[model samples]
Target: MLILGQSPTDAPVGTFGLVNLLAFLCIVPLTVLFAPVGASLAAKLDANRLKKVFAVVLLITGVRMLAQLLL
Candidate 1:
């Protein structure tokens, strides 16, 4: 919405690209900080239970998308 809403205002191309670049830059430090924490959490979760949790999440998201498209 920011991009589309601002596009009509004559915001410069470089401004849009800079925002994109800054957002992308945020990922590097975040991954460096969270990767070890995520790995430790994953190690504590049982594989089969984790798989079932992911399956349920996917199923719910899929159903929600289908509902949105249909209704």
Candidate 2:
């Protein structure tokens, strides 16, 4: 991916860190803007069904984390 005497990683550490920080910074506002919209959509769906699905997913994640910790 190098051209014109430049590879992407040739960028300075500070420059790369700043770019990454800015990218994450942008996600904050986006989450704030979309939170209410996503909440409304989920609310319109069958709440009980969604809750059951979410509970199963959470249980699986918790089990996996515990297994990893025990190992």
Candidate 3:
């Protein structure tokens, strides 16, 4: 929604400006190179383990957001 709501001329927030675009461009090649490796590793992981890992990631992300809000 943020992307759709934003106009081209809108001031860039830290994640949505020209600098971020350049950074994304720079990382695209690396992402392309490593994504398949990541996919293979994920594919090898058991479904239950993957779900637990994903849950932990989400839990950590939620805690970080809560910390930021409190701080």
What is the per-residue lDDT of model 3 for residues 1-71, given as tens digits with 9 covering 90 to 100?
45445445765554563345666778999999999987997999999998898899999999999999999
Where model 1 places Cα greater than 4 Å from the true spot, the runs are 1-19, 56-71
Candidate 2: list runs displaced more than 4 Å: 1-41
Q: Report the Cα lDDT for residue 16, model 1.
A: 65
lDDT against the true structure, each candidate: 0.74, 0.73, 0.79
Q: lDDT rank, highest first?
A: 3, 1, 2
- Sorting all predicted structures by TM-score, with the top scorer first, yields 3, 1, 2
Candidate 1 C-alpha lDDT tens digits along 2-70: 544444356444446224546656888899999998788778899998888779989999999999999
For lDDT, the strongest prediction is 3
* Pairs of residues at least 3 apart in sequence or in different chains that clash in candidate 1: none
As a whole number from 0 to 100, the lDDT of residue 67 in candidate 3 is: 100
Residue pairs clashing, model 2? none
Weakest 10 consecutive residues, lDDT, candidate 1?
Answer: 12-21
Model 2 lDDT tens row, 3-67? 23433576644334325445556888999999998788788879898898789989999999999
| Residue pairs in collision within model 3 | none
TM-score of each: 0.48, 0.43, 0.61
